[model samples]
Target: MSFIESLTLMLALMYIASLSYWSGKKWGAVVTLLLSIGAVAISLYWPLALALLIALPLCLIANKFAPEEFKTEIKINTLREGCQQLLALSLFLVAIQYCINAIQLKQGSTPWLMRPDVVDAFLPIAGGIELKAIVTLNLWDQTHPAAALMLAAVLLTGLLCKRAFCGWACPLGLAGEYLYALRKRFIKAELAPPAWLDWPLRMLKYLLLLALFYIVIGMPSESIPYYLQGNYHKIADLKMALFFVTPGLITLACFALILALAAWRRQGFCRYLCPYGAILGLLSFASPLKIRRNTQHCLIEAKGMKCDKCTRACPANIIVHTKTTVRSDECQACMRCVAACPKSAALGLSLKSGHRVSHKGLLVLLLLALFALPLTAYLAGFWHSQTPDNIRMELIQVIDRVGH
Candidate 1:
């Protein structure tokens, strides 16, 4: 691994540990912010790692340009959230594009993978040198080399942006959000994450991580990619195919169950069953962005709009009314409170000021993310190297009907 990458892993690990110790220490968040900036800088910025020189101010602008009331330091009138929602109407667009391409004159299924088609459009990055290739991950085929870096990228982004990936980038999150909208329309249950169930349930996602590892480690190392390479792919070796095709409807069912939980208790999936949410929730402890309060200016003093609205509107169920300080790392930086605050003084993400975060914990997360950098990369490459027998060179001759 490159020294900088090693340094990054170290920093990410330290960030994780510090979160465990202090949970939401401001210093830890600061450290994470710096490290995250540095990682991106070194990896993508080249010789200077000067991305921070640019990024920090942008984040400040994100905070300052947040909304007028938040910037005013005086009144509260037009605080209608500016954080853009990352909802995907792309599914419909892609579906439309597919219909246009259909050779079929008439078919019930449209044979084009109509409306919410499973196809993914290529996303060029690094000046189009790299791309987000289309992908699928069902029960049989699992690990996606094209996706691991994407996952890691999201994981790393959590440090500064809070849950921006979930709030802004993840298509699955959009799906979940849409389901949630449908849920509110059909049912009204204020499900609470009961203390007994809440903490235990969050462990499920990691268990899922463990399950993924177990499935991967058990498969023939050579055929891993074929299993993960997505649908109708030739990788359908008997054992791997059986395992790959395994994720089942239970996956959707799981979301349905989580949605049901959220309907009853707010953010039930995030608070409980989502592994990514679990990691984000844990790492979020070090997020530089957060919801803050000024107890002195708080509504509890006058009992009007000061703190009531921010706390009430917080979908995460964080008690913003009570938290005068940016103490909880679990905040998503969703800016919901920033928008909802009738008294803008009640919430904002601070860069310099906050309770002290643990510098020691920062050290730990740095070490870990650094270590995982190459390890995860190697694993990614390793998984990809294991080609499936179904993908045999000889088979191409049989299918394409041209001489090999």
Candidate 2:
């Protein structure tokens, strides 16, 4: 099948699965399962099918042995941490494989496996900006299908769950969480910038978004800034891979700085500097699903007192107890506030229609659909680069010469 054809089929299946699940009917699970099987069959991707098969039984077993409701919070947190670690490890392995491929290429040997452009796929801002260039500058043939698909996945997630991807799926956020945990364990305390300082810094990402839009849409293609240019973007991607493959002083220093900032203030980069996250945050304001506070049941209100546990628990520092519905752009739907609330039913995730959402199950399904579609296309030989091998080789040579 052609790449676009495969992608279309995958998207159709995803839409069906998502719709079924969103219906919140008893049979939604069955329909989603069938659609998943159909997706595997359509793509002829046995590996994905096999993984799902294995996972289904394990999930069943886990559900059967699941802890009581009150005890489940700890289990859920553990599961989230485990998933984050697994994702981080998977990225590390991919980096190692890419390095091996590069080494083989340098030694004049044909690498058996080519590295997929997964990093670029995660870059939704870059994809959106490139799409603008395509539409405004008539760069029709330069469509990056993988990146486009990834951006669509992210936006779809935002529509459904309100920045759930940032909370549950972002590797960088997971890393920041880990760093914060470590800092708390070692230092016993962490500091946040004063609200006056933080408020201004938080505006930086929006300004950056405006600047990037100008670069992608206002500037002529030939006059685009150096780092934002195509070849240079590829070089940056290469450098990212090299950070894992062959870490240098710069990479280590940058990593340390990020960790330090994350330790100082949870999700510091995401809160202040991530243009992609800023875009998602804006879209998430329109999401129907959000954390709702039962003010009447809240312990603080009940006692005619003030308790800031939920606020303290929030990584985004949102005043969760004050709002009946958390519609803040900064809310990532992490549910930390919900878990931290001492009063039962004081906090929960719900749709605007008042239907409560099952956080873990729905989030897991969304993430599964997001990754499975692209992976199925990849397995169908329809998701890799359309660029000629000779051109790619030439670009690699140039990157190596520039010592990026």
Candidate 3:
């Protein structure tokens, strides 16, 4: 985007943030503010950065002086949706920038636009390998350090916030949501697999995760440097982009299956295929935050009613009402159940001590934990790729021929 366009987006975000704060959706305001800051910082527009820095203090002041009514709790579902939309847009822009850089390199010219290093977030396999290298050999990946940083950030998020990343930030999850909505339009009832089938299907992701770990962990430590510095690894992101852009018949068929399964069951891809999500789901077991049920406040226990709204509202098909504490890996921490409950106190995301973490506070912590890596990495001069532009230009030309 041009300077004028970026400035307009920043100002628009700030305006929406102000409106969100005034309307008592404080998390929405905070998201917009953070997005604006990220936009300026990534683009390295110091003037706009100064503007955001100034506006941030003012926003904090406004929030502090706001009336009690304006501090009302944000609906977690709404906050998740807003976050999904913003992140979708951000990723879209990154894709555009990445393609533009590739095009520039293909034309044998230096890219005028700075490459968006965040694109490395897609290279989880590379990141995993690099992480092993870091642990075993004290070697940092020069080609895609951002990948490792992103991996750390996501792992930290999983450790602290469950699978909120999948619920709120993953683009694939956002796409699956629309597919789910479309499914609901045609099928009035939920279509879930029986336990016999569901259990095996869910194991697919874990098995895939194990296969990935086997390859990464089983590699001789000596070969780590060779793999990281290989030409194929240097253009792995471009190779990934091409996989979607120029998918073969098998790739298309796999996509068809994914869409059909997602329509048939909620979060089917995350549940059955995403190795990254499998890692997060496992780590989330150690997270202090979980959805806790209060029998004293619940309609099922307190009023002897046959209410199962929380269970019905769950996209993950978790029986939220049956469990005093939701410990299932399938739980995305989306808080759909909490929002669906008739009694406000019946369901909540709480620590072990029963101290409820407010939705706003959760958003703040999740975002901070997730972004902390990129911010710190950037400050430490480790976020961007160290690959020279001339080498990248040459590599893009033979990207098709380069292979593992």
- lDDT string, candidate 1, 313-373, tens digits: 7776677776665555446555566667666564565544754222232223333432344
Looking at model 2, residue 121 earns an lDDT score of 62
| Candidate 2 deviant stretches above 4 angstroms | 1-26, 49-53, 56-76, 122-126, 133-144, 219-236, 239-256, 302-306, 372-382, 388-391, 400-404
Clashing pairs in 2: none
- A best-first ranking of the candidates according to their TM-score comes to 3, 2, 1
Once fitted onto the true fold, the runs of candidate 1 whose alpha carbons sit more than 4 angstroms away are 1-87, 91-145, 210-259, 262-264, 301-306, 326-329, 354-404
Ten contiguous residues with the weakest lDDT in model 2: 1-10
Cα error, candidate 3, residue 74 (Å): 2.4
Candidate 3 clash figure, as a count:
0
RMSD for all candidates, in order, please: 12.7, 5.5, 4.6
lDDT of 2 by residue, 1-404 (tens): 22223333333344334334444453765765676677667656554555556545544554456454522343445545655665566566665666766666555566665654565565555566555555656443232446655676777788778877788777888888888888889888658889999999889888987876665566566543333445645444554555566778897887777678788888987887777678888988888888888878887777788787889989898988788898988898878787788875778889777677655554555565466556565655645555544444556666655541
lDDT of 1: 0.45
| Candidate 1 residue-wise lDDT at 206 | 67
Model 3 TM-score relative to the real fold = 0.86
Sorted by lDDT (best first), the order is 3, 2, 1
